[model samples]
Target chain A: MDICKRRLMKELSTAEKGLPSGLTLVSANDLTSWYIDITVDSNSLYQGQIYRLMFMYSPNYPMKVPNVQFVPDENRPIPIHPHIYANGHICLDILGDGWTPVQNTVSVCLSIQSMLAGNHTNERPPDNDSYVRSAPKYAQDSRFIYHDDSV
Target chain B: MPETETYHSETIYPVIASDIAMQGTKTIDSLNRLVDYSSLDYIDVPGHLLCPICQYPFVNPYTTKCGHTFCKECLIQALEPNVDLSVECRCPIDRRPLNRDYVEDIFPAPKIISNMVNDLVAYCPNKSRGCQFQDQRWLLQRHIKDVCDYALISCGGIKEDGSVCSQPTHRKFIMEERRIQRDYLLYGYSMLPPTNARLMYGSSNIHTKNNIKDSASSSESVETKDKSNSLKFDQPSKNNLHLNAIKDTKLYQKLASQDDMPLLELQEDIQIPCVHQESDCANGCGIKITKATKEAHNNIGCTKVMLSCEYCELQVAKPKLNLHFEQCPEMTISCSAKAYGCTWIGIRRDLEAEHQSKCHFIAMVPFLSKQDKKIELLEKENKSLRYHLDNISQSLANLPSFGNINRNDSVSSDSTTYSIETTESLGALPVLPVDLSMTNASISHMLMENDRLRADLDHLTTSLAELEMKQNTLFMQENFRNQEVMHSIKGMINTLRQQIHYILLEHRAFTTNSSNPVHIINQSSKVASTNPELLRRRLSDITRQDVKL
Candidate 1:
């Protein structure tokens, strides 16, 4: 990573309220690639589970949101939360439609933590079947409308 | 009604299935299925973190961005003391950014994978020191909060820690320490006891018992002191008294904090709204200002501004004179009429007349009194016109039927020509003649005397169907007029009901014993938004603080 991008990732990974889960940054086979899990000790639905997530950023870095996804679809697995897609796509506007470059991973993690915590309904998104198979990628298309926090 | 705990047995299935699906398809199907049901079953996690920087398990690992991590304690001691603000620690990647400390996700193994991968991992890094770690990541927070060996217990002094106190915990710690006394007490005081004596000297059991006793005594002392503090001023709240003594300080501390929630937050806390209007914004802004310093600013003169604004000839003054006048001008300030959205900014020399005539924001129509005058005029003209039209049409429609059957058989030819002319004149009016059915009952109700004809229609025809159709049409027109009158009457009633509901809701806010005051305030706020007089009257009565909710 360039000096500037790496600097932001450091403060964001360790700053106050940064990365709600105790998720640590772990490198894979390739030095450039990285992924890990966040154990959200939140009062949210995704509590008590370690959510494995991958963080992929283009060289563009801070100017664009990092590609963060709950890996292995573990704690926040898709076919579950109504507000979240089974394909690991989220319906939160702040994560996508309303995303501003100013937002950091800390804010993103906290938002997700709350998302998992407060969801009373345990059903998957209504369009899970269609979105999962036929439109598997649309959930992350960035073109999908994210009008509200709720689905 | 909310499901507190419904998905216990079946919850295992979803957790397992989701865990496998997230790992991607590279995972073996049989292994995935095996974990799909056995999710979240973990004896403990054996995370022997290996530091990327040291090429070994992290001694005191520190993380860095670009995923090229480090051993924290070693790096800190080796590098500059203050690494956070220093520019030395750069990310090992593209050299573009200096991501200082590397951080790792906690317990990366999902419960589904944890049960399997956990067996493959090394021993706990902290276990060699005799720390018997047997908890999973899920239980770690609870462990640290309730069972951590090093958890800091508050000293529970009366004043906050920021202020100096006559006493300190270190002194108390030394004097009241059971472990310390265990070494001293048995040697000095000769007090070893049998196992049955729970409070015997020098036992680990005695140490724990003493700690509990000390905790209980200190808490009771704190409670007794709190009671005297309140008894001098505040009355008892029964069970809520202790709750309040504990809670009020917390609330006060929260209020002292820089960014506490407004009244809406306290509404959640107290579960009630403050409704004393005397403490509200008497300035008529209808905004509730927090009770703070400078109470004098609350009396700023705003009455004149409200009136001037109404006329569109509003004046302005500096805020020091009256907060309302901060932007008001000597000349009439132009405020766009709130109707037809005339957002024009103009000088108000003749603004009142200009508004009365041209202000689109203000409705062109005037007050209810003026509206009543106009409506009354329209109603009178409509009623008379309706009666005249009804009379003419009814006479013509029933004329044929009302004519005698014997006379029709022998009527003269000139009379028939004369009758045709009369029917043509009557056709101009929008009314139906009386029916034959009415004539059968009584001729008086069926007939109308004409200007030129000596005989009335009822005196002539008594059995024509065409006359009946015209009569019914005339009757319908009369009913239409009646409907308008009834509608105006109903409108007045609705306006009255709305005004009363508004006054009652507003009046209840300032008064005490408002068991349902929040409900009242909510309702009044909603209604007041739509009603100008209700809003204005309420704004005058309620203090600004009352409007915070």
Candidate 2:
């Protein structure tokens, strides 16, 4: 019990220290889960866009990577483009095949914003629905598949 | 719980437990306006006379008790039940103790039947629902009592029960207010009542009740004005007429009457130009400036001031006139505040900035760094376009030189074979001696060199992808951390709310106590604990950091 408390306390204090700018931590109405809205420099395609990424820490976090989902909703107030689905589901590999324990909600959002700033293909997968539901369900150090770099 | 203010029954409560404050001359007559006086139905008090001997409603109209056939209270008093009474009880039959336990303790009649065709209550007052009243006030007393729910009372601001109406009822009253409005409507000015004259609604409340003891006891009578079902006051005029409703004798027709202010005594406090030398006095607040002063205002330096209130009319005044406004109650009111398009009239004491902060037309907070962002986006798009154009141009240039070899059949045929050959053979071409053949040397070098370059490019692309993949994973973990902190803060707030609830419960006991500074201090601290600003700021910072990440 003490260990869990200490770990969460440390995470909270760190989040407090980093929030001077626009970093926000949105906990589920219940304390069971939380998500962060990864914002990019508004100058980019992802600017003014808030890419929501959820972090599901196990009753044991950090020791293992928390389960994460880049809950992109195109229906959100954020502007839509080719790369982002209307559902806000991001096609970035880091949230999928490139999943790793070391990754966190902030890094994933930054990666997506950067990913958007550098790519041009706006189309979703031919089977976008299936892809979202059936992509590798867990982060297990899958080999990363990076394709486009040109913005 | 507050008393229902049922129009029939009254409940008195003491708010200031210490020395009373000015005896609060407010006599609020909350008549149930939703009541259909047109239908004329009720089972409340003052609806009937009681028998003097039995203290129940009068029956058989016998003059036996003191030879007076009044309600029981009258005859009971005549009996000199108490030692102070001067009258004696004389039974009509014998003049004994009047003790006829012979059915004496019971209701006298088996039934009463007047056919009530002319009486008002055969149908339920809740005419919307169809329950017949079956009897009069005394018989239906237990049934029509507030708990039974057939009672229909409503305020203009509230629905059928003084709560905001979810459904609307379209009904209006023909009140004295309508008559007074007729005066203003016809004359363009509200004439003051004659000295020693009373407003009209007073008489309406006095005699409007059908048949009851409303005047059964009082010797003195006062009258003159007001509507039976509705009361009226001049709509923000300089002239005023007052209303007075004597309590205990009668009640107003509806509960909506409670919201109207009884300015009979303090009418001047709200209506007269007691400020600014009364030079500006006219139909408007405080007073109006003279024509010369108007010229001065239109040309001379002036400070713009605005005052607004939900319940008052708008007024505009000058700051130079501040000295004259010190004693003016309406100074706190509108000061020519036309900018807001508000026509509220009130004193500065009540019209604070609270009204302005909530104005719907106020502008929203601007987007942060909007210009810098637009510039940054333009620059980034420019850079990407430049790189893309350069890439296409480089490919175009490569096609042209290769075009030369393709047009020359000798090289074209050989290149065609180069593309189709087995992978092992394509790069295994012999290195021709430089002195032996120029075309052959060029072809061999170009093919082998092309293979090596393709291999190197593949490796670099693969590495770049890995780096991007890592960046995304890191972002997901960071989001998880922030969520944890928000929950902790919310939990703290809920705990504080519970504590405050307990403190409030405890306060009800001490609100009656005269001395208890400690409770006040405790309440203040408990209130302070619930401030969400700290949590809000904390949330702001975390969101910002998440963006940077």
Name the best candidate (by TM-score).
1
Q: Under CAPRI classification, how is model 1 graded?
A: incorrect
Write the residue-wise lDDT of candidate 1 on B184-274 in tens digits: 2222221321111111221221222224444333323432333433432354343233334333344434544634233222321221111
| Candidate 2 Cα misplacement greater than 4 A, ranges | A2-5, A20-22, A28-31, A42-44, A72-103, A126-151, B1-549
Best-performing candidate as measured by DockQ: 1
State model 2's lDDT.
Answer: 0.39
My TM-score estimates for the predictions, one after another, are 0.20, 0.19
Locate the minimum summed-lDDT window of 10 residues in model 1 chain B: B268-277
Each prediction's DockQ against the real complex: 0.02, 0.01
Model 2 TM-score relative to the real fold = 0.19
Give the per-residue lDDT digits (tens) of candidate 2, residues A12-71.
Answer: 555656743344776643334677766655444445555666666665333233555556
